[model samples]
Target: MSTTTAAAAIPAGRTEPDPDRVARGKPLAHLDGVPVYGWRGAPPYLRTKTQLAASRLKVTAEQEAAPLAYVRTRDYGDVPLHDPAAAVKMRPLPSSTKARMAARRTCSQCGKVRPVVLRGRPCSVCRQRAEKAEQRLRARTCAGCGTVRELPYPKHGRCHGCRQEQLEAKRARIDAWLAEVTVCAGEGCTKRRGSKKAARAWLKQHDWLLSPANPNLPDSWNSPGWPRRCTPCQKAHDAEQTRRQAENQARYEREERERRERERREAEERVRWAAAALADPGVVVLDTETTGLHEQARLVELAVVGSSGDVLLDTLLNPGEPVGDASDIHGITDDMVTGAPRFSDVLVHLTALLDRKRVLIYNKWFDIARLRHELELHYRDRAVREAVEEADPAEVAPEVLRERAAAEARLQAAAWLDAMTFEDVMIPYSDWVGEWSEYHGNNRWQPLNGGHRAAGDCHAVLACLRAMAEDVPAASGADEVSGTTVGEGGPWSRCA
Candidate 1:
């Protein structure tokens, strides 16, 4: 059915809306005897043009199938709403559009079809040829020596070397008259001028006098700025420049040698240290994966591997905090560690394991600081629990008691940390690798290939130690270190 009024004309082929579906949303008004609804108030049968477009569909033209109704939206207000059933799939590009695109792809100069739009310029190949031609116009071979080089004057080409020789000839006249060096070599007449200024003015007159002899020679040599030097003086100047260049080259080579020797010494020292650490029964590799890198970050996992390849300890430690932001990295979530023991529960066992032993940790400083923070938290919680149980209303305020507890906990935590011994494996490894960072004034730290988990990272540290302990050849030097290549098989090799 079709409806036409002065206000609007209803389009045909609009699917009839079910009354049951109509009950879903309240229809606004029958404006000009046609259904009208606001954005959220439209019936299920009604789809706006945007909704149709999103589905790769278009509303059929008024001649084909008209809109079922209208929807009033905040932006682009009162757009027609059509039944999706009456909408058609979007049509492909027309022949005129294809022709226009083809024209754009055709190069303006070469007239060849290109992968990209030429944008009024020639294709890449034609453009390159044109650029080369322009370069050739601006450059020419020197008449002397025949080396193809850029010349300031391409028409009367003379390379810098040849031009310098010509300039020296002009300067030789000045030196001849001044009695600084050799006699004049000016053609036809070899008389000397009075002062340096008189000689320069006369030189220009001489160029005009002898213009036919050197018709192609540039007039730049006749300028006042032309540096005057005799034949012997020129030889001495060239010799000084050559000597200075030789000295600079020697200095560079000396510096390079010193740098290489220094690095070799450092690498040998690192290897020795690694060997010592490996031989010592006290040294053990330790690693931990935590909630975060922050001081307050709690451990999600902890592991220790003895030098003798014994797995000393490996367990998950629940921090009782949701691993929301950091779970993606270490892949530990709240559910995974829900039943695991807290840091407080594992403190005594950890202390026992590390007693009278040297713990080697990758990035030891950060991990130790993190461990101290955990300890502080544990003591604070213990103090708070004890304080809460023995609280008296008359004694002090709750906040004041809590503050005192925290302060005491920090002191105890510090004392506990002071007793343990640790060494940074990352520092020695970085020194061996020898990539200097100017910002830090130290070697750049390498990433731990096996650091995704606590146990895996412990193995990675041990692997690094083993790699360092091996005899490094002097010739190969410490050019580069790769996590995968250095320590072939271990937890580090898992990724490779």
Candidate 2:
């Protein structure tokens, strides 16, 4: 058995060279055992120039055994190796430590990490010391009545009760002082003593000398003032005077303009009323047919007969809604009104044509109510609904609902023809017909076609009016005929 002893080696206290210094030197000649180019005089080795040059040409070689090198047939070939100096050096990776180190410095109030310079400083502590100092100084002496009192902050400068009493005493003193001094009698001027002296100096500069003639003159009057009054009072008084003059001028101009407008309006009104009373040259009788007796029912057809008794305008309005039983009488259908403009669209044209024109209908009340109802519905007025509900239906004669609908169709057509009302040119011929019949000892009036058809009914009304106009003749005088019309008879009169 062979025994091996472990020997104790001596420790070398050599330190590693600084990396920054090594980088500043020449290229490395060798790292570990690999051959490389570097500064010859660096680190552990130092050699003469001749020896160092000689070492650059020397190469190391490994010796093989004589028998292996001389083999008759060499099956293995030597491979060229890459230079060790050409290999890249890799840096060691960073450590994966995850612990957090506590900071030495922190804010006093919030315990947050603070910079070294701010460790002991606190804003709240400094503020408290400053406030305490201020409180002490303020309490050292009282501002009012010269009395000393202990109070917090600014209030320490004075005691509350003493301050109040001192203010009252000072006010009384000032009032007594003011009472002894003479003041100018000028408006809003209450200068006294020192202030009066300043005012007198101002008057002297303005070259205004006190008049010996007027002993009771205001101090401001001692100055050569503007033509009106004292300097202080002049500005306000002049401004007021100017304002009043402007207001009076404006009032007069407004009154003149309004008077002219009134005269013009009155003149125009008289002309229009007179023109409307006279018969228009081209008048057309108009009427309508509807789906139902109610005003809510849509217009079915419209008809218009010219003053010459010609059919000027006639058309069917196919209300988008159903016609129901109305179709049996007028023979209109939904397909007929499919492309027609809504009532709202047509209302503008209708209103223009009827502007200031009186409308004639067989039953004026029923036609007016239905037309007004449709207008209100299209316009979407709540007030119209209220008015309709409050209206007396009996007076309007609900019995004439269907007939009135036909009348409205006619009126709409006639308005489209000439933009005139029946009241403007046409009077109720039925009254005259009844009067004629009564004079001939006949009790009954002429019969009106009941069913709602646009063309037929319109023609009937036109014929009645024409026949009456021919028989009665237009009056030359302005006096209105009374006993000759409806609603003019006694309680039991046949005409009523």
Candidate 3:
């Protein structure tokens, strides 16, 4: 009978309720007026169950996807989550909340509160007051009398009396130190001190060590006696001596060169006088232009015209060297004479033309000097070489050799100015023409058309000669035209 009451017949498929749900209890819906379960609510319950299962699956997936130790919660509109701990207590309002909160703050410096109505910015009275106080503190005060005083803003901190006193004290200290000082043994050291200790201190300050034998002297100042000079002074003196020596050497060389030139010129002048005596022509004009005013400058161009102002054998001779300053005045560019004949090529023609013809020139000394140098060079190269080659070494004695050399040099120098200068011919011609023109009431002695061109210059000289010839008085067997009066048709009419 005890067994018969058997546990109400259990259904074959039925099982026990979940143990986890029994422990956790059923979850409640957030919506209002919703039942947990029943027939009328069965559909919703089933649907909720299905949705819950799906939601559970999503939550599980989210949890799996989320970073470790992270939690997720649902949001309810307009309903804050109740914190269990806070719900247990009831606290009073804080003091900060009970007071009327300030919208605009008051300035600490000026005690002025800003109005809430003003929107842009607050007042800066505190900052402005701080800046003005700083400026006042920086304003000048008299240092001597300790009184506040007005001064230029730039010099606001210093008073005139204090500044002057500081300068005077510095100067007095410097003078005192200078007066007590002695020259140091060290090179270029002019430092002074009052005592041996101070001197040692100074040497130590300057990183100098005292000599072992002479404790007063620095190691670098070990020379036997007082130095002839300090390093800087010695350097300057040596430089000056070098400069003076260079200058003296230059001057000596210059004087020697000038002496040689003078001797050559004298010999050339003698030869010119001899040539003029032999030729005895009516007129000869010599002209030359040079590269520079130095003895070494080469001749660029030369011209010799006759009394009739004719260029007897006019030729452009190449100097065989660079044309320098001479081209500046003469306009003889290198291109103008590139294919011109060399001086050596035209020398024979030049010499033949000058035979029995007086030489004339302006500034004869300079012209002759340059000519002499050029001719001497050519003659030595030509004649001296020939003589040396033809003579026997055994027969050429020392005296004879010397004599031959001297004679050749003289000949070379002579050729430079033989009937080839203004002094010998042109000057006399000019004088004669001038006098004759003046006598005839025609005082145009200078070359015509300013004489810039060579042809123009020769024409001027020819004109003068013609005038002179016309001016000559009639002589026995002279033409009637020459004897005619000045106003009549005659030589004078022809000259005019």
- Most accurate candidate by lDDT: 1
Q: How far is candidate 1 from the true structure (C-alpha RMSD, Å)?
A: 19.6
TM-score to true structure, per model: 0.49, 0.29, 0.31
What is the lDDT of every predicted structure here? Answer: 0.72, 0.47, 0.49
Runs of candidate 1 exceeding 4 Å displacement: 1-225, 228-243, 385-395, 430-445, 472-496
Clashes of 2: 21
> RMSD, each candidate, Å?
19.6, 35.5, 37.7
At residue 330, candidate 2 shows an lDDT of: 67
- Order the numbered candidates by TM-score, best leading: 1, 3, 2
The worst-scoring run of ten residues by lDDT in candidate 1 lies at: 487-496
lDDT of 2 by residue, 1-496 (tens): 2233322232357555665333334433443333333332232232222333344421123311111111011343221222222223334333432111112344455555544434445445555877898767766666656665454425324566765675566545444433433353446665432454544465456443333222232323333332323456557777888999999999999997676455334433433433332345345555776777776787767665554556755666656588788777766767776776655666665565455644445555555555655654444333334445766777766445434445554555544444445542122333333334446654234455634666676666655554433322223212234312221222221111
Better of 1 and 2 by TM-score: 1
Give the least accurate 10-residue stretch of model 3, judged by summed lDDT: 77-86
lDDT per residue, candidate 1, 1-36, as tens digits? Answer: 334473254346565566635735555776556667
TM-score of 3: 0.31
